[model samples]
Target: MGQGADHLTSNQAQVLDHLRAANAPMTAYQLLGRMQNDRGAVAPPTVYRALKALEEAGLIRRIETLRAWAPVATVRPGVVVICDDCGTVRGVEAPGLLESLHERLVAEGFAEARKTIEVHGRCGDCAEDRA
Candidate 1:
């Protein structure tokens, strides 16, 4: 908490740490449990506040379908891909992926739409295990 600590408040730092270390997305309630020791009296409001701060800083993102949060994979605008089998939420990365998607949407007459895509399915690990 000493080095580069001024970038975040203690609560925000604690919340980000938990999300960064998580293998899967976590709800705010779950984050409270993980941060209670550091936060000393973590509650729903406290966690929510921290989450908002982290989101504002672009350090994390909330998966609307899962109602959980995960650390942002990159600074670029991208889509969220949620693994249904393992509940892992990750950012999708592909060259010009967003642009292609936008082009398709525009062709479909949804040019004015604001896109927020979340593709749900088994991830590579689970898919391989099943095969």
Candidate 2:
């Protein structure tokens, strides 16, 4: 699906590259700082625009609660799990059952329905640390 990235603008490509290489979600300001450090003096609006374009292209997902973005690693629906203590973000590919549910929703006259399911909890490592 990200095959369309071949046409991405330079800034958009930069943003996507950073997200793809990141181990966790990143906020726009973080991306801007990285870009600025590497390329010298990047504008906040530039980073934001690139992020918007990448999101619209379905190449990234926003962790709404964290106000952060993560690269899409698969074509399947994603269930984002976030750690409250360490701020770790992980994406789980949901079962095909969700596709059927979405289809049912569309059939029930909810044509514009969109959902992003997020689960928040402490990760195993964090839990172990606490114990």
Candidate 3:
């Protein structure tokens, strides 16, 4: 519910609402299918536009591994986690770790650097299933 919502069309708002309501990440195609089934018909571009806006606003994130999107409740910068098996993602808080790494890099005189720490592994359900 950021200022990004103000820029969204009603269609975009509807798409964002649906994505937030979903329990799992969903591809644009999947969202399009649901919209078509419920609203009778929908265009692909509309979904893409809405997703792009939501992503830019940091209200949602795209899971590269799953090729899907999910809402982001927290925005603690410099943190990202991804489940390798199911592709479920969660944001984390690791300022200490990040600070340590940053200090080390600064000592080495690395001026510009961005951090994206992605941990890949099976989620709880996948681990249980495998077990």
Deviating ranges (above 4 Å) for candidate 3: 1-7, 74-77, 84-87, 103-115, 124-131
Give the per-residue lDDT digits (tens) of candidate 2, residues 13-88. 8898898888778899999999998888889999999988888887887888888988877323558888888876
TM-score of each: 0.78, 0.79, 0.71
Q: Report lDDT (CA) for all predictions.
A: 0.77, 0.82, 0.74
Looking at model 1, residue 47 earns an lDDT score of: 89
> In model 2, which regions exceed 4 Å deviation?
74-76, 96-108
Over the stretch 59-128, how does candidate 3's per-residue lDDT look in tens digits? Answer: 7777665778777763235566666776556777888988899888899999745565656666688889
Q: Which of the two candidates, 1 or 3, achieves a greater TM-score against the reference?
A: 1
Q: Please give, for residues 1-131, the per-residue lDDT of candidate 1 as tens digits.
A: 12223488888888888887888888999998887766477678988998898887777878878888887752134678788988777776765977787788889988554556788988899999889
Candidate 1 residue pairs in backbone clash:
none
Worst 10 residues of 3 by lDDT: 73-82
Candidate 3, residue 109: Cα displacement in angstroms equals: 6.2
Estimate the overall C-alpha local distance difference test score of candidate 2.
0.82
